[model samples]
Target: MAMPAAEIEALIRAALPDAEVEITDLAGDGDHYAARVVSESFRGKSLVQRHKLVYEALGGRMGGELHALQLKTEVPN
Candidate 1:
């Protein structure tokens, strides 16, 4: 199964309303993606925590509807 990039962005934004999310189709396949997310909510969080937030936003879609993701997280300057 494959998930749409816009749906991924929407899921993340639903969790982090202030997040700036960019989703890329790395292999030109909907199942593989790279995402860069920046949010003020990540300021005090660690790298693992930030990723957890994004993953959580996906609602368990990883390894299922979404096959793979290369993720990067950042806090706003």
Candidate 2:
């Protein structure tokens, strides 16, 4: 089963309440997604750490329910 975009957004938001998350269906197949996440909490976090946060928010659904995710994270300037 593929993870819904809303679920993705909700999960991220649950973890980072001040995040601005945008999810795109890259292949229009619901399994592949591209997400741009902007959050104040990511301000001082390393790139790897930021990605880890997003992955953690997904709750281990990455290679199972969700096939591929092209993720980008940024902190507000």
Candidate 3:
């Protein structure tokens, strides 16, 4: 099963309402995606913690419905 980009964005937004999310379909396939998420919530958090927040938003779909995600997270300037 594959997840849509909009759904992924929606999920992240739902978790971090202030987030700025950009989703890209890496291989033009729904299974592979790249996401850039920026939010104040990521401020002061470690790299691993920032990623955990995004994964938590996805609700455990990372390896199931979502095959691969190249994720980047940052605190806004």
Candidate 4:
């Protein structure tokens, strides 16, 4: 099954309560998506680490129920 944008956002928010999450369905398929997450918690974290955090929020759905996610992570200014 494909993951919903709301589910994606909810997972991200659950991990980063202060994160500003924007999820887009890139291919009009529930499996493909793009997400931009901005959070103060990302401060001091490396790009790889930031991505890891987001992946962790997904709780291992990256390649199973969810696929092809173009993710962007940034710290709030």
Candidate 5:
């Protein structure tokens, strides 16, 4: 099962309340996704850390409901 876009968005928002997020279905199968997220909370985090925070929001759904995620993150300027 693939994670729903709304679920993904909600998760991110929960982690970063002021986040700006865009999600794209790469395969249209709901298994693969590309997401761009911008948030103030990412300010001091490294790229790996930023990505980890987003993945953590999924709460262990990565290999289950979620298949793959291509993520891009940026801190607010």
Candidate 6:
């Protein structure tokens, strides 16, 4: 089964309640997605760390229910 955009947003929101998140279906397949996240939590984090935070939010689903996620993370300007 593929993951839903709303669910992906929810997962991200749950992990970082103050995040401004946008989830896009990259391939029109529920499994592939792209997410842009802006949050205070990323203030002092590196790109790897930011991506890790998002992957963690998915609870290790990166290679399974959730296929690919191209993510962009930034601290709100």
Question: Which candidate number has the best TM-score?
Answer: 3
Candidate 6 — what's its lDDT?
Answer: 0.93
Model 2 lowest lDDT segment of ten: 1-10
Q: What is the per-residue lDDT of model 4 for residues 1-76, given as tens digits with 9 covering 90 to 100? A: 8899999999999999999999999999899999999999999999999999999999999899998889899988
Q: What's the CA RMSD for each of the models? A: 0.5, 0.6, 0.4, 0.5, 0.8, 0.6
Please identify model 3 stretches exceeding 4 Å from their true place. Answer: none
Across residues 1-77, which tens digit of lDDT does each residue of candidate 6 receive?
Answer: 79999999999999999999999998998988999999999999999999999999989888889988999999998
Model 4 misplaced stretches (Cα beyond 4 Å) = none
> Residue by residue across 1-77, what tens digits does model 2's lDDT show?
88889999999999999999999999888999999999999988999999999999999999999999999999998
> Residue 33 of model 3: what lDDT?
98
Model 2, runs deviating above 4 Å: none
Report the Cα lDDT for candidate 4: 0.95
lDDT by residue (1-77, candidate 5, tens digit) is 86788899999999889999999999999999999999998999999999999999888898889999999999877
Candidate 4 versus the native: TM-score?
0.97
lDDT against the true structure, per candidate, is 0.96, 0.95, 0.97, 0.95, 0.92, 0.93
Score candidate 5 by TM-score against the native.
0.95
Report the candidate with higher TM-score, 4 versus 6: 4
Q: What TM-score does candidate 6 reach?
A: 0.96
Best by lDDT: 3
Per-model TM values vs. the true structure:
0.98, 0.96, 0.98, 0.97, 0.95, 0.96
Candidate 5 deviant stretches above 4 angstroms: none
